[model samples]
Target: MRRSKNRGFGIALGVAIGTSVGVAVNQVAVSIAIGIVVGLIFGSILDKRSQQQEK
Candidate 1:
């Protein structure tokens, strides 16, 4: 449960960061693209961390 929550938080954080970066850069397409990339990166990081913790 806590792990799930952390993952969600990480995703949300990624999206927020991506959106902010997009807005700052002044491009909607770039913002959405960045958001997805950031989300994936966050997800991967979280997955790796979880695996490490499990080991």
Candidate 2:
């Protein structure tokens, strides 16, 4: 979707942040998992809103 054009950036940013935090806490795996989940939730919200607007 045009409105969700930055989805990849959003997800990547989320993962990066999560990994950074995980590194700080020495929980790389858990932090990455949480980050990815959060990123997906955020990206989905953006995508849905964009689609709704299209309608």
Candidate 3:
């Protein structure tokens, strides 16, 4: 449960950062979409790391 929550937080943080950076770079739509994708990828990576740690 704690691990899941942490993963969720990580994902949200990634998305927020990615979107903000994208917007700052002036690539609005494309940046947002890319940000979302990258966020998901990063979230999954974090999840994997957490799982490995648990074991």
Q: Show model 1 residue runs off by greater than 4 Å.
A: 1-9
Q: Which stretches of candidate 3 lie over 4 Å from their true place?
A: 1-11
* Candidate rank order under TM-score: 2, 1, 3
Cα distance off (Å), candidate 1, residue 14: 2.1
Clashing residue pairs in candidate 1 are none
Q: Model 3 misses residue 25 by how many Å?
A: 4.6
- Candidate 1 lDDT, 1-55, residue by residue in tens: 7566666777678778878777887886777676767776777788788889999
Alpha-carbon lDDT of model 1: 0.75
* Candidate number of the best lDDT: 2
**Candidate 3: residue pairs that collide:** none
Q: Can you give the TM-score per candidate against the true fold? A: 0.64, 0.69, 0.62
How far residue 31's Cα lies from its native spot in candidate 2, in Å, is 0.7
lDDT of 1 at 34: 68
Tens-place lDDT per residue, model 2, 1-55, is 5545656656777899999999999999998888888777777778888788879
The lDDT for every candidate, in the order shown, is 0.75, 0.80, 0.72
Indicate the worst ten consecutive residues by lDDT in candidate 2.
1-10
